[model samples]
Target: MEIKAYSRITADKMVVNGSTVYSSSDGENINLTDLYRHLGIDYPKFFKMDNLCKAGFLGAETIIRDAGMDTVTPKKDCDIVLFNSTSSLDDDIAYNNTIEDDANYFPSPSVFVYTLANIVTGEIAIRNKIMGESSFYVLKEFSSSIIYSVVKETAQETSANAVLCGWADFLNNTPDVLLMLLQRTGDGKIQFTAENINKLYR
Candidate 1:
């Protein structure tokens, strides 16, 4: 049971390497709609995942917008669990660089807001109006079994129909995001196997 999606965002481009679509990228300042159109994703139906948006030309927001919204039946339940290695290092960098005058020594609210890795989940919730359970985890490595255990417990206790889980790590000016939208069938069929999570980037 393996479901995977991989996305890459650089200075002026967005790339989605996944099953539903082969590849897609766009230039700088093209806006979300244009990026989606270039990626061949349905526009109106893809209004979700905006929470993962980033601040720059090509950032997390671009990745989330490009990933499109997960397609689930109405009233379907889902949990969004995200993990990042550096946890808003870029925001911290920006905050640290915003100087020159004593009056502006304090961090800007906009940049400060993104300093937390978990803030992206809230952005997604606000955009899609999703009120389901949400969480964030930070670890040296993304262990499949560890995450699987967490997901299992969340599903059993909350009766969640699905789990949008993945690793979103940014380092040294490079960001890598891999997301898996997993659904739990009534038969307890977990489509994502340990091996699948291991091969998420592939």
Candidate 2:
């Protein structure tokens, strides 16, 4: 597989293919909604997503658009494989807060739906019409080898034409995301490898 395009999002900046596309002001935290509006994206459901989903969605969307995949007809030949360390703890805390107090018990189904880390992949798939295999793995920490192995095996076993895979972790109002679009045949020069993945992630 070849790396077609990649995007990264941190607390104060968004980068695509080694270039800084957007950056927040000094000492100011990056607001996902403001970034969404700044990017001119028209997805309304974005406001309803938790921070984890928003970070992952924005990363995936930026890479897809950077790779010029958004203009093409949606296809099911692409798979999504994402890795994170938090495992939806951010949203889990919010969900728990809603039900912790017995007198104020208000379990929100909307918030409950985002308690799983894989929900980010589902949101991206639904938006892009990607019907291929979608998986999310929570590792103790970022492991480039594991990511490379899973992505390689998934691509080979499923015979998928492409794959969107990377790390997305958000917690305590902090975000660290690195999303990449990989394809079997493309003009891109970056080879899909653990070393390259590690380099780009850093």
Candidate 3:
């Protein structure tokens, strides 16, 4: 398998396939609403998503688009494997802070829903109509071995021929996402491996 395309979403920029899609000096937080508008996407549910889901959705969607596709791979052939350093720390902290003070406690169902890191995967899968294996992992730090191993294992265990896998972390209001669309057969631009993954990650 090899990486067909990728998208990197950061504080002030959106890059797809090594080209800068958008850039700004607006500091750390990314404005997902503005990005969705810029992409000419009409997905109404985007507004309801948390930061992590937004980043994952945008990154995956952008890369898949960059790969020149209208019809997605069959549901059973696509898999989503994601990794994050903080898990749902950002959302969890926000939710906790909202209810920390008894005098001004507010428990939002919307906010509560984003407390799971895997929910990002669910949203993306739903959008792409994918029904294959979906998995999420929390790491103290990035590990190419973990990524390579799990992805390879999933491919071996399931009918996955296309895997959307990578690091999508939304922490401190800044998103550092790198979503790679891996295919079992492609141009072979760079053979998928632990070394190559770590190299691209940096």
Candidate 4:
């Protein structure tokens, strides 16, 4: 298997392959909703997710779009594997903050829905009708070993034919969402390897 397409979204820039797709000038966190709008994506549910999910969701959406593989394989053949340092802790803290002091206590289920890291994968799966191995993980930092291992293992699996995987790491006020689409065989520039992943991640 190999990477058919990839996209990286930093705090101020969005790059696909070696080309820049979008760049923000204000130097703030990337406004996911606005970027989604600019991309003509109007999924209302996207607005309901926390920042972590938003980053992952947007990254997956963009990569799949650029790859144009929505119909290349059956829905059940698609998989999504993601990794991040913070998991959903950012949203956990935000959800906790809503009810910490009690004076302004508010516990909203909408906010509570994204307390788990897997919710990011869930959102992408739902949006794309993906029915294969959807997953998410936490790490001390981006590990090419972990990404390479999981994708390689999945490639050897029997069911999955196409996969969207990588680091959707949104944490500590820095967002790094890099998603790569992999297929059994395609016009992939390079084969799947830790070195190739590290090069594109940078």
Candidate 5:
């Protein structure tokens, strides 16, 4: 597979295909919402997403747009495979806080809805109209080998024409996301290898 496009989003900046397309000012604290606004994305549902989902969404959005794959039509042959270390711990802690005390016990459905880490994949799929296979895996740390293996197997098994795969982890308002668009044929110079994935991730 070839990496047609890739995007990285950190707390302070967003990079597309190795280019710093957006960066926060010095000493400025940038959040997902700020990135959304910078991208001029008019999706209102983005506000309802947890930080994890937001991070994943932003990364996926950037890559899709960068690759010129932003279309109203659904990508039925595309798959999404994402990995993270924290899972949904960020939202898990928030949900826990809501019910930790019976005095103010309130289990918010909005917060509870994002308890599953795979919800980030779902959110991205829904927003991008990707009808192919979607999955999320939680590991002790980021493993490019695991990502490459899963993506390869998924593409081969499902006969996927393309795939969106990488890591999206957010905790305590910190975002570390990397999303890559891969296809069997493309003009991209980067080959889909574990070593290359690791290098780009770093």
Candidate 6:
């Protein structure tokens, strides 16, 4: 498939949104509202550790919507595939930090539910009402083969015409996210093979 839209987020210093109010490692508090403004997008309805999953979903949704697509309740078929390196490490940290306090220890279930890497898919699916196949993966860096395989599988299984895949990761406190909506087209196919992903990233 061919990439139609993309968004990247790299926050070195920022406040952890929807999580405990801790200063980001880079000492920069990224106002999600301000971030959206910078990207020329209206903030989404859901924001919050509820952590990276929700944020990545918001990023993907923003890109899709910005592309002038009817993201909400799509009339046509589509799929969502997400990937990351840390696997909700930010949420884990937030949860652990909350329970680490002896005097203030109240870990909420609401927040705990967002500890999964694939939670973004759920958020996007719910927001867009997209009842198509969805999946998530984790890796140290880009995995073009895995991405291509997932999209191919989803398209074949769901009869979808396009797939929105992403590489969203949180490193040390900096959020580095890249979300792309790819359309499955004959002319767009890059022969998503192992030889290419390894070489492309290298």
Better of 2 and 3 by TM-score: 2
Q: How do the residues 1-202 of candidate 6 rate in per-residue lDDT, one tens digit apiece?
A: 5655555555632222112222334567454555544545443555553557645765676667755666555635778878877888878777787788889989877778877778878877776676767888887767767766766677778878667776677646566665666666634534444454343333
Candidate 4 residue pairs that clash: none
lDDT by residue for model 2 (1-202), tens: 9999999898889999999988888778788888898888999988899999999999999888777777347778999999999999999999999999999999999999999999999999988888898999999999999999999999999999989999999998888999999999988689999999999998
- Give the per-residue lDDT digits (tens) of candidate 3, residues 1-202: 8888888888888988788887755564568778888888878898998889988899988887777654355577888999989898889988998899999988988899999999999999988877889999998888888988988898779868889999999988788898888999999887879998887777
Worst 10 residues of 4 by lDDT: 65-74
> Mind giving the per-residue lDDT tens digits that candidate 4 earns over 1-202?
8888888989888788778877776777677777778778878888888988888888888878776756234588888888888888888888898889879988878889888988988888888888898777788898999889977787577468888899987766667988888888887577878998999998
Tens digit per residue, CA lDDT, model 1, 1-202: 2243344443344555433332233533324445556556443524432223432212323344444553232324767777766677766777667754687776566666667778776665554454668888877776777776776676677777656666666555444566665565433333576666665544
Better of 3 and 4 by lDDT: 3
Model 2, residue 101: what's the lDDT? 100
Task: State the TM-score for model 1.
Answer: 0.66
TM-score head-to-head 1 vs 4, winner: 4
Worst 10 residues of 3 by lDDT: 65-74
TM-score of each: 0.66, 0.96, 0.93, 0.93, 0.96, 0.74
Model 5 agreement with the true structure over 1-202: per-residue lDDT tens digits? 9999999888788889999988888957567787899899999999999999998999999888877786488899999999999999999999999999999998999999999999999999998899999999999999999999989999999999999999999988788898999999998599999999998899
Which residue pairs come into collision in candidate 6?
13-28, 14-28, 14-29, 15-29
**Each candidate's lDDT (Cα)?**
0.54, 0.92, 0.85, 0.82, 0.91, 0.63
Give me the runs in candidate 3 sitting further than 4 Å from their true place: 26-29, 69-74
